[model samples]
Target: MQLKQELIQQIQSIIATAKERAIRSVDTERVLMYWQIGQVIQEEEQQGKERAGYGEFLIKSLSETLQPQFGSGFSVRQLEMCRQFYRTFPNTNALRSQFSWTHYRTLIRIENQDKREFYIAEAAKNNWTARQLERQVNSQLFERLLLSNDVKEVLAVARDEKQPSDAKEIIKDPMVLEFLGLKREAAYYEKDLEAAIITHLQEFLLEIGNGFSFVARQKRIHIEGDEFSIDLVFYNRLLQCFVLFEIKTTKLTHQDIGQLQMYVNYYDRFEKQEFENPTIGILLCADKNDAVVKITLPENNKTIIASKYQLYLPTEQQLIDEVKKEIEKLDHDKMNE
Candidate 1:
């Protein structure tokens, strides 16, 4: 009976693999077909003798004729999208077979070529689904990273031209936790927030970015007869170190920073292996004062980071304003120097 069950399980796995491949093959063909259609439309527009208003009329007429026989997928909007797909990715070789039409549509909408390219590379590397790609784009993940790092180097890492050597490359500030279903105005205990995070561990992991796996919660530690509990602990395989997190329900303070530093020291001295990198400490709080953080940490400090957590997603304008403020501060400091 055991042998029969093993044989049946193997057959089921084989069938599942074949089915997935078949779906992927069909999706790739559809993507290619759309690109081809866009190419033809672009060529026709270029060849037309009268350029003014000709493109609109061509798309309308084509859509009317095609929609009748080929269905609504050939609507003017879709044709325009196809044309944009080709325009955004002019070289056919640049298109990946793994990406579906949904992915291309999302990519083509990004106006900045560099940011678009970064998203494409990240999506492919992370194997992000269409919805996941959309979420990251909407969240302005690229802009957030640019706040602290060089754009050229970040893009190079995204494109696989360079590698990230530290945890800072993967961590994002003000991580959005709207998916946790926590009320923004509601006052909750750190334990409650920790519970929510564990309940939505999958979503939390996704929000935390790649290479992180949850290790423990309320992890107890004893040092010199003093006991302490860590809010959360994670291991980042890419950085090859333990990641320690502490949750604060209010604005970060010097004491909070010091306490986290102590935990980090404990891990570095006792928990971490000699081969492992130094443990990275993150303080997730409701608010963060950059000036406070700068003043509290040593000038050479790199292991500890304090980031804000938001219960809701900020509006697009809010993100833009924040970026502008950051840039202006940098410029002001340079002028003062």
Candidate 2:
């Protein structure tokens, strides 16, 4: 019976693997097909430059001919998308095979070259599904990262041109937790939020940034007959450090920062391996004032951060305003320095 069970398991594994490969193969071929079609359309349009509306006319005519034969995949909108995809990613060598047509579909819509490139590198590195990539794009992940880091550093980290030495390089402030299915108006306890995080750990990890793995919940520590329980703990392989979280369901105060800092100090002093990077602390708060946090932490502080958690995803206008505010703050900090 045991031998038969093992054989069944091995066969199941082989079937699943084969199915996955087959899907990948089909997706890759479809992407190549679309790219080639787009290339032909672009070349033909250029060849008929004598006509003013030739490009638009050409796409419509091609779609009319192909859609009836090939189904809606060759419809006017899809064909236009194909042309745009080819235009956005001109180099055939640059197309990543892991991406599906959906991934390229979302990517081609992005107008900014840097933002598009950043998402491309990050999506490829992280193996984000089309939905995951779309969520990050909608959440304004790139713009949020720019709140603390400059454009050059952000791009470099995304490209893996430089390792992330700072937590801010990857962590986003005002993290979107709409995935938790929590209501915005309702009051939530620290435990409630903590439970939600654990329940949706995968999405939480994606929102938090790269290279994080769950470690412990209500992580307890002892010091000279005293006891304390940290809210959550995570290990970041990229940063080579333990990240401790202290949840606050209200506006942040200095005490919150102090408490998180203590946990960070405890981790660094007692839990951290000698070769590992310093343990970092994050105060996940309902709200935060930037000035208060700056005054609470030491000038040279790198380990402690105060990040606001939003129950709902912000509108595009809200994200834009947030970015503008942070840029102004950066300018203010520079002048004070």
**Judged by TM-score, which candidate is best?**
2
Error of 1 at 158 (Å): 1.6
Summarize candidate 2's per-residue lDDT along 1-337 as a digit string, tens digits.
2568888999999999999999999999999999988888888988998999999999999889988888988988998888888898888999999999999998999999999999999999999999999999988899889878888999999889999999999999888899999999999999999999999999999999999999999989998999999999999999999999999999999988988888888888999999999999999999989999999899999999899999887898998898889878888989988
TM for every model, in the order presented, reads 0.94, 0.96
Clashes of 1: 0
Which candidate tops lDDT? 2
For residues 62-162, could you state the per-residue lDDT of candidate 1 as single tens digits?
99999999999999999999999999988999998878889888999999988998999899988889988888888788887776777897798788786
lDDT per model, in order?
0.89, 0.92
- What C-alpha lDDT, on a 0 to 100 scale, does residue 322 get in candidate 2? 89
